[model samples]
Target: MTASHELRLITLYAICARLFFITLIVSASLLPPFDSSHKTILPAADPRSLFDVFVGSLLRWDEFYFADASRNGYQYEHEWAFFPGPSWARRLVRSVWSTGGRRTISSLSEALFTGALTNCLTVWSARILYLISVECTGSASVARISALLSLLPSSPAVIFHVGYTEPLFNLCSYMGMLNCMNAKWAQASFYFMLANSFRSNGVLLAGFFLWGLIADPFLRKQKIPLLNCLKSILYAAITIAPFVYHQFTAWVTFCQDDGLSVEWCKRFPPLIYSHVQATYWNVGFLRYWTPSQIPNFLICSPPLLLLFWSSTDVISRLFRSHTQSGLAKQASMVLPHMVPHAIHAFVLTSWILVAAHTQIILRLASSMPFLYWSAARLILEQPKLGAWWVGWSVTWGCISSILWAVFLPPA
Candidate 1:
């Protein structure tokens, strides 16, 4: 079959899988959320109309933070922890959809619209993932499998459909990688900038692209002008400048309010997000050594191990390809293009070990494209297991979704 035909098939499969997953996600909202007697959890939006079932279900957990940030800027210090991209995107959408009126859109309406909008973007993101897999492996079947793998409703799966930053971040990240693969460095830099603005992980993603530009002969061999290179650098620098601004903001805010000296404020910077996380969220580097953190790590290890294995192969091939001549060198670079996934997975794992909550690893793992790619490679190698894999994955997704809907441990 032609590549276009194969791509069409993959697109159709992705659409169907997304519809199925979304249906379950919306339906799951009908099930009552687990009682939160002791935990200081945010209250979910009340499902007033039919639309609530679709959007209301996703307003739990960190959704509140994003919603609050969007409605009221970074009024509270803890609110700065959010990157603001997702919330800003939602506010933009709400503004465009709103008719001229004195009253602003209700927070409920804003949250609902944000959830629906992000979820729709996720469908397109899956299409991009399929395209990337096809570009890398040149196997339509692998592409299909990779796209299907994205449908699994892991613990943080709801984040994609909610007001959280993951959907926007994931979309921009995938687009950046796609542009990078096509050697559209400026475009890739732009998307990466947006991705970086959405989440702190974008910094690591920028580094990953830098690695590609430096290590890949194909990229370096391009006879680009100095001006273009400088442009790329400018875009990248602007992307990272936000974090620096946040740090500066923290210092100014603290010094003005606490009556501290400029010198003392410089030491604090604007790392209030980090401080809040450490003090309130109990997050610190290498902080997951406690017995309670064991389950979170164990549950997420399978995908992380797969990611590590995939990354190791890339690192090995990166070296091996350097020694080869002609086409062999190019082929080796193809595998190493996936090295970013490994780096992302590594960062998340390291964060889990040292600083953040262990459960977050589950959500973060969904960002690793190699996890899906590696799964596709395994299933395609043993074609007989394909159906079984789908069945098991869907079954697991259903159980996890149910548990997550009830606010229970799902990893």
Candidate 2:
């Protein structure tokens, strides 16, 4: 089959695979002792009907927070921890079908709609990921593998079709990366802004943009005027303006509480979000270190190791290679490309190492496309083991989804 045909087939297969996995999670939720009492946010009581079991099963840990916050607005202090992006996006989406302009909807229905929207976004993300991999590696098979692995039973996969920010975040950030790969700086900046609105890590894309300008020979050769360069920098700052605006919102909220004086409020950086994260969730670099969190740390270590290993290997080649021809030259050319991946992986891994909830690394790591790219490369190098790799990946993904559905550990 032609490459385009192959890509289409893979896209179809990914959609089917996602559907099958979601069905399994729904089935698992209907089994014995299927309790919904443990849910923190979504309205799940006894699954008196099939609808309750299916809808209730999907609203796990963070979904409740998003759903409740979207439906009610940030009513409590802890609610401030969530970025306004996903919650507002969910409401905006739900409003499209509303008879009038109403954004409010029942919590359960909102959860279901948001979950479905997330799944759709994930499918689109897989398509973009496939295109990026093909563009970068010139190997359609590797690109296919990368896209498939992204949808495999990774923790992020569980959130792919759930009511979470990842699907939207992935779509926007991957789009930004794709634009960067094409050297469309302006378009990339737009998507990067959308991404930052969804998650704080969206700011990381700024590094990607800077690296492209510095490393890409074609960009450098253009030797654009200084005024245009400054304009580009100004646009990039504008893209991140939403985040700066949110900090102002947080500061205003803090000031209204009256616990802090006006002088301190003016002096303090937007400590509201950081305070909530540290106090309510025990989140900070290395602040969560304890013997109890060892299992989570261990569970998340493999991906971390793979990312860092790939990054180190690439960096070593860039530094140590002396040859100016053939494979060494090709590696040297790719070295600049690897710069973004190394930086992204290191910063994310550092967050996990310093933070208490290492389990979150599974979800947060979804934004780092290099991880999937590395997995695809490994599969390509071991062609004979590809089948086994796919099997293990899909099976593990299903197991993880089941665990998530049942509200089990290591979510």
lDDT of 2 by residue, 42-79 (tens): 44466667777777777777777777777778888888
TM-scores of the candidates are 0.83, 0.87
Model 1 residue pairs with clashes:
247-270, 250-270, 284-354, 284-355, 285-354, 286-354
Give the Å error, residue 43, model 1. Answer: 10
Candidate No. with top lDDT: 2
In model 1, where do residues sit more than 4 Å from their true spots? 2-8, 35-55, 99-103, 153-155, 218-232, 257-270, 324-327, 330-336, 340-348, 382-392, 409-411
Mind sharing the TM-score for model 2?
0.87
lDDT string, candidate 1, 160-240, tens digits: 666677777888888887887787877887888888778876776665545555444454465555565565566567657
Error of 2 at 77 (Å): 1.7
RMSD (CA, Å), each prediction? 4.1, 3.5
Candidate 1 residue 246 Cα shift, in angstroms, is 3.0
For all candidates in order, the CA lDDT equals: 0.66, 0.71
How many clashes (backbone atoms < 3 Å, residues ≥3 apart in a chain or on different chains) does model 2 have? 4
Q: Highest TM-score: which candidate?
A: 2
For model 2, what is the error of residue 283's alpha carbon versus the real structure, in angstroms, after optimal superposition?
Answer: 1.8
